[model samples]
Target: MSRDHQASSQHDGTAGDVVVLSQGDHTLVILYGDVDVRVSEELEHAGRFSIDAARRTVMDVRHVTMMDSVGVSFVVRLAAGLRSAGTELELQGPSRRVAELITLVGAGELARWLPELPLEADVSAEQA
Candidate 1:
């Protein structure tokens, strides 16, 4: 992704912890929530919104607890779109499960781009 494209996204109103969307000088993040079939939709919605707003975008999924095909496709296609436009697309915030899924799917083994989850997030640590 472009060095200038940096953003963090937080998704609200879900069983998982709040997902974050923070914009850097030039990056977009698509955080992953708890296990859900609708994850793909959520991820795509966030990404399109960011692109529509005319911001350089990157997708972060390092925090994802579990990812299925839907979630996978959303990110893969999103990255393709950015590449076509010469824009940088980053996928960050992947959980351990997500990391394994990436390999299982053979999605180019994108290990270098994964980012760390927020220190405050409680993926499985149980919330108060």
Candidate 2:
């Protein structure tokens, strides 16, 4: 991992935050605040950078307060890209709102990326 590659962005008008952390073979992306269409570009850039720097990437969205379809699309697309490159992508601790949106989109299957969830939680809608 490249410590120098770790970056964070914050702007008054932006709806969310992105912080990249280097963790050996994996990169940890901490997202906070609202992650709607407003931050799509930032998310995409950060996702690509992390994927390029590490074979495994973990997006920790425990602090995300809100999200929309754009956020869901970003995660799904990122995961697919990483998988195609023989890398791995995982989503950890997504907030209830974000989780609900993902579930509403029938993206609970994407929970395969969420190692923090128990096996039952991944397979059952009750936990989603």
Candidate 3:
């Protein structure tokens, strides 16, 4: 995979980063730090670029420390748009706080896009 686009900035005194990595028909968007209203514009721009660049987009937010309603809305809307376009959008590894916020807002179904745990891990959890 090659990183074709990246943007980072300090908005409202909070640091945020976006990296777009592409491989064939797949693109991975790595997001870090806070993703709130302050950085919505930047995030939206990046999301659009990713959607246009690949048939499958994976948004990896594991490094994101915080997210607000705007961020959640962005993800939902992006996914919907991609689906309508016959593409796919997946959210990977949202932090617990972000996950709770998404769930609270009735977006828990988005969690289905999260990267699955290893088979061994799933089996152990089931046994436990």
Highest TM-score: which candidate? Answer: 3
On residues 1-128, what C-alpha lDDT tens digit does candidate 3 reach at each position? 77677665432334666777787878787777778776787778777887677478888877788887778897787777677767878777777887788778866664346664444457899899
What tens-digit string does per-residue lDDT give for candidate 2 at 27-88? Answer: 78877778877777778877788767757888887777788787788787777777877877
How far residue 32's Cα lies from its native spot in candidate 1, in Å, is: 3.6
Q: Provide the global lDDT of candidate 3 against the true structure.
A: 0.73
**What range of 10 consecutive residues in model 3 has the weakest lDDT sum?**
6-15
Provide the lDDT at 93 for model 2.
73
| lDDT of every predicted structure (CA atoms) | 0.54, 0.72, 0.73
Q: Give the residue spans of candidate 2 off by over 4 A.
A: 1-8, 11-14, 111-128
Among residues 3 or more apart in sequence or in different chains, the pairs in candidate 2 whose N, CA or C atoms overlap within 3 Å are none
Looking at model 3, residue 64 earns an lDDT score of 81
Q: Give the poorly placed runs of model 1, Cα more than 4 Å off.
A: 1-22, 53-56, 109-118, 121-128
| C-alpha RMSD values across all candidates | 6.5, 7.4, 6.1
TM-score of each: 0.60, 0.74, 0.76
